[model samples]
Target: MTGPGNPHGGDAGEKSAPAPKKGKRELWKLIPGFAISAFFLWRTIKSIHYDDLRSLHVVQPVWIGVMIAFLLGSYTLRIYRWWFMLRRSGAAGFGVCSRVLLTSFAANNVLPFRIGDFLRVFTYAGDLNASSSTILSTVILERLLDIFTLLAFLVALLLGAAHALPPVVVRGHELNVLHFAEPVLVLCAVGLILLLFGAPLLQRVVESVVRRLPAGARTEKLQRWALLLFDAVLKLSFAGRVLLLVSSIAIWLCEGMIFVSLSRMLAIAVLPRGPWLAVALSNLGFLIPSSPGAIGVYESFCKAAMTSQGAAPGISGIYGILVHVVVFFSVTIAGGVAFLAHRMARGAASRPLRADLADLPVEMPADLPPGISS
Candidate 1:
């Protein structure tokens, strides 16, 4: 059933117009995330003593260049991974996928709980002719796969580092790798089990709860859509799941290499395998769902990871600051240029849909089924 001027007019009476006030509440709901970000940034800045800024010049330009290269490479890999995921989700066209990813990253950096994520879904929806809800569901599935990959990598890194480094040879600083291993593995296993089966369970629970709501066609349709999305997500092919997992790990590894390069460029002692751990930990911090670009959280966590690895506080702080600078500027410049080009091309391609609409036949076919309407 559809209403007058509805794209699909049907036997059902005219659909009610949407309430103008329905979206007003959304503006208010955005305040908390932004407020939290501001508070976090303020506290982070206040916590940085002037002494932490000392020796900032130790980071050389050549090292900065290397770090920048690694950062760019990481972004490239991310684009590739995103393209793969989008294609698997029936969102074809590499160019559109790349643009969506680049713009999403840019939006994430600019907007405050990374609202750019929703923008990515919207962009993909327009480009792929797919539903926003479906695209968003894929994103959720992607994140779940990412968490599993991160846990697996963390466990492996801990085990390998334990064997490679002597327990007490490096002074009283005892490397308690084993201490963290059991708990981390247990958590990873639990998370994996949940990802494997928890989604379907969650859908059933949600359906039961939604069923108790006031009965109506709209409610029924919403529940049906929710179930459909869950089923589509749960039915991801084994190969597609494996691809997501592998790509997720590869993207993180590339990012770690970038961090390690940046650390070295800053003349910080490059731990043989420490950057991998640092990257894993720092990226995990970002998953905390803080502000846009994870400004305060990223810096604080990076510094902490470096400090734990025996780096001088000042040097680590400087490394964190410089890496952020490089990444921010590089992405901003590149993405801005791409965005401008995309807009220009879109403007050139756009044509009036009314021109084609006017050519449609006015009379309906007599043989058409009674329930079928367009």
Candidate 2:
């Protein structure tokens, strides 16, 4: 097998050595996120005393059932929304969608760097009979919709219940939440408006930018992918867009109910609007990009929101810990079970699947959204 190109090795080009440097580089990138999580965890722990452990008692055990109910409701709505978004793509059935969605979030809970998102898009895209671009477009849209809804909830809080809540104090200074949230809210609103109304313009701009890139297989592939993002949104009718927004609102409200239920379960005297505020702030904290499951970042944000509204520091810390545990473990365990079942079923059928984008075509298909061919 020794030839001119492989004079010193057997199948030298066919089986190249793995790039250890690339693996090391990826590991190195995760160091900062872990450090950030550690720092916040330490800060959160130091603020809580041994007495905080007492707050773990469930005063009204019935609320425990309520919390679980809302948790299930939120995930159910989320799975349906994902399916609805990909309906035109001929996505899989409700059961398939649920398993994939839960497995993805479970991956996010256990793995760092939000790997679950890419996992969902790459691994299940083929099973769903949709392109990677379409799946990714829906994922990005989901995040945007969540952000918009959360911000809107925050604004509603300020308008409807700000007077009922205590001022948020940071470092002995009264903090104005609205002052900061309003600008971001405005930006998100404007972005959504533009995305929905000016999709064609966005598509054109993407084309113009793609045209400027050096002509290559990679560049052309990227062009189709970028175009597909806006194409999915553009394809939605006015009624469909409204339905999506309404559904997004329902999903977050269900999550908000979880916080409310937890507060009641523990008998923690949160303010009238405390649960909603915590929901808005804590989920928004996810934007900070901490370690898997948001770890210390989630607790810190949740505790901060509760404490600002006059909840005891010990109870606030406990509340944060309880909420994190419920969310982190439930999804991770359910997803783990679902993934194992899926694998077993596939193995029984003797079907092998590769969860990567390499098998996809470089060129857009004729069935792609109408403007993608242009």
CA-lDDT, candidates in order: 0.61, 0.76
Give candidate 1's TM-score.
0.67
Stretches of model 2 off by over 4 angstroms after superposition: 1-15, 161-175, 201-226, 348-374
Clashes of 1: 1
List the lowest-lDDT window of 10 residues for candidate 1.
365-374
| Backbone atom clashes (below 3 Å) for every candidate | 1, 0
Against the true structure, candidate 2 has what lDDT? 0.76
Please name the candidate that would achieve the greatest lDDT relative to the true structure: 2
**Candidate 1 Cα misplacement greater than 4 A, ranges:** 1-54, 57-66, 158-181, 193-236, 270-274, 348-374
lDDT of 1 by residue, 193-220 (tens): 5555475776777788887999876676
